[model samples]
Target: MTLADILASLFPAGHAVRVTDGLVSGDGPLGASRLAVVGIADRTALGVDGACTLSRHVLDVVQSGDRTPILVVVDSDSQRMSRRDELLGLNEYLAHLAKTLLLADAAGHPTLGLIYGHSAAGAFIATALATRVLAGLPGADPSVMDLPSVARVTKLPLETLQAMARDTPVFAPGLDNMVAAGAVHAVLDPDSPLGPQVEALIGQMGADDIRDRLGLERGGRPVAHTIAARVAQDAGGG
Candidate 1:
């Protein structure tokens, strides 16, 4: 779906969002409350300027002192891969955007991500992955890292990486893999009204981050939750 289509489906009641340069920000009615919406659109490559812009909006929401739920609608390319972006410290800008979202979540705002289209790499992390709950619509393609890039980094053959991905959800790209790895908490039915599904998800959210546990239960990265728990326990004892 296009961003407009997704927004209409998500806010059947109404919305006041503005999209400029692929950056989205606004509010939408959500059953007795308003959801503060912020995100990227148009499959644009996220850059330092986009990251800083998003972070500023999130910080504005946080400072408002409203316990409003935040919705991050994502449709982005990977972080911009240009010499200019590198020289401008794109990583730091992305980190700031992620931190601002985390702060909003920590400050009693329920932060949720809805992926309706392509999202990848650091752009995915700073927006969708930072959210407490991430839901995806059918055909949402979110990739932390693509196989070609992984092959280059790991010095593994492309065919070998593809074969491994077939068996493991660990670093694969797709909605199924993301769900298996617990990056996506839910996949809404495209046949149904998305507004109700989004509302239900908001109602079901909890304070704890359960992605690791979900990953273990779903048979993706089976040792992650166990190792994390052990480390936490050991740190507390020390």
Candidate 2:
């Protein structure tokens, strides 16, 4: 079965989930059960418009006293590469998703993100904002262009680029780099005990109460705490 299929199985009766055109999308079944799954199709192909529309709709549901758990399956290597997307304000679309996730959290929906593929730029940001982030054994990687893209962007030779990636955490792919960067929270082999983990997360869901097990708290991601730190510093407390 595909990863999407496995995720769909995580939901039970009254859960809304389906795979259509390669996008795994769903919503709450009843009056608001903490359960929904959104899958990213070709992370690089997902643009701001689509992300904005989908994420906005999700937020609308959350505002209605329905504390549904939103499961995000992120696997994109980059945002849309078209100039049209930028002209149309891709940043705004991505920001909309961010706000929606924050709203979901504030409304008591436990937002869980699962990374089974590439993640980069907007894709990375969207998932990182989730309350919990889970990574597949091979899911963690550069989440962006390989050394070749970096070479082009940096004007460095491919050989030199690869060597640098090996030494620099920024360019490296795989689980270690993502983990060190605080992108992935927990690493699990496909064969590992996912059921129990899911249950544990479900039991821990709360209204605006986040558990710092994976991405936000313990995952060594600088950006995670950077916001809070800035706020605290601004408040003259830090």
Candidate 3:
């Protein structure tokens, strides 16, 4: 599904929206909150401008102190790579964006990210990963980096990396793989009515990162549970 489809699913008919430089800002479901949805459909990148825009909206929400829920709809395929972006300190901008989202969360605002398309690398971390809860549309692809990119960095043969991905979901780049590894909270079905599901989740919101536990329960990342338990036991002087 596209970002437009996701937006339509969340907002009612005739809901007013403001779109500027690829960032879409509007009132959320039933006028309960504000949403800043970021993405460029044809050209898949989140640049410094987009980052700043989202950061500003997040700061606005924090300042409002109404605990307005933040809805993130990410569809970027990559972070913008350019000499100008680097000269402008793109990393700092992304960090600012992340910090703003965290501040909103600290202010008691529930932040949720829905991946509607391809998301990877630094852009994914800056937007989707910053959320309190992250989910993906069934066809969404989420990754730290693509397998070919990883192979180039690690100096591994492409065939070997492809083989490894089949058995390991940790760094695999698909929604189902992320859900299995606890990277994505869930993969949403497009046919389902998203409004009621979102409202239900909003009602149950809490300040807990429970994906690791979920991974263990789903038999997808048992090592996370084991390591956490071991760390806790050692900390207790056991």
Candidate 4:
């Protein structure tokens, strides 16, 4: 089955799933009955459109407050390639949606994400902003795409590009690599106690905030420290 089909099975339906084109935004089972979900179809699922859809949904959820969960489901392929989208303020829309997500967290909402499909680039970044991130099995591919695609524009060689991807978390695919970079909070089996676990997370949250240490990133997960050390090094300090 596709990612949406799997998520539909995992998250019980109660929220108002918004569907415009092929983009869908909603709070799965943990969300309130009136939560907004949006979907995008075809090439229209480009930059500005996707960002606008996300912004609108986020705003609606923030206005709804603690009544619903902020569960984001990611199953995207890529961002806008249209030159018109580039000309338009697509970046503004992305920033707007991102800020709205932060606002949702501050307003006491459980922002959880289930990535059952490809979460590439902006779509991946959007989903990862959640309080908790869950990846189910090996169905998802999280590459920034192969170096050949980049090389088509940059004229870089396959060997050189492959070498770079070997060391960078940015180019890795699959959940193992993503988990190594702390991109996901946990990996759920299709038959695991996902629902109850999510509910437990909701109950344990004294406030809407998701604790970094309590989730999958901490508790001696090897990748957690690896990613952390990278960040620290990037920041120019220990």
**Local accuracy by lDDT, each model:** 0.91, 0.61, 0.76, 0.57
Off by over 4 Å in 1: none
Which 10-residue span in candidate 3 carries the lowest summed lDDT? Answer: 34-43
The global Cα lDDT (0 to 1) of model 1 is: 0.91
Provide the TM-score for each candidate, comma-separated: 0.97, 0.73, 0.89, 0.71
lDDT of 2: 0.61
**Predicted model with the maximum lDDT:** 1
Write the number of the candidate with greater TM-score, choosing between 2 and 3.
3
Tens-place lDDT per residue, model 3, 145-211, is 9999999999999899999989888757788878888877877768876766666666676777777
Q: Write the per-residue lDDT of candidate 2 for residues 66-101, one digit (tens) a residue.
A: 666677776665667799989998877878777788
* Pairs in clash, predicted candidate 3: none
For model 3, the superposed segments whose C-alpha errors exceed 4 Å read 31-43, 229-238
Candidate 2 segments whose C-alpha is farther than 4 A from its true place? 12-15, 27-34, 42-44, 128-134, 137-146, 202-234
Which candidate, 1 or 2, would have the higher TM-score against the true structure? 1
Judge candidate 2 at residue 185 and give its lDDT.
52
Give the per-residue lDDT of model 1 (tens digit) for 167-211.
999779988999999889999887777778888998898877889
Cα lDDT of model 4 by residue, 176-207, tens digit? 65665555656666665456655554555565
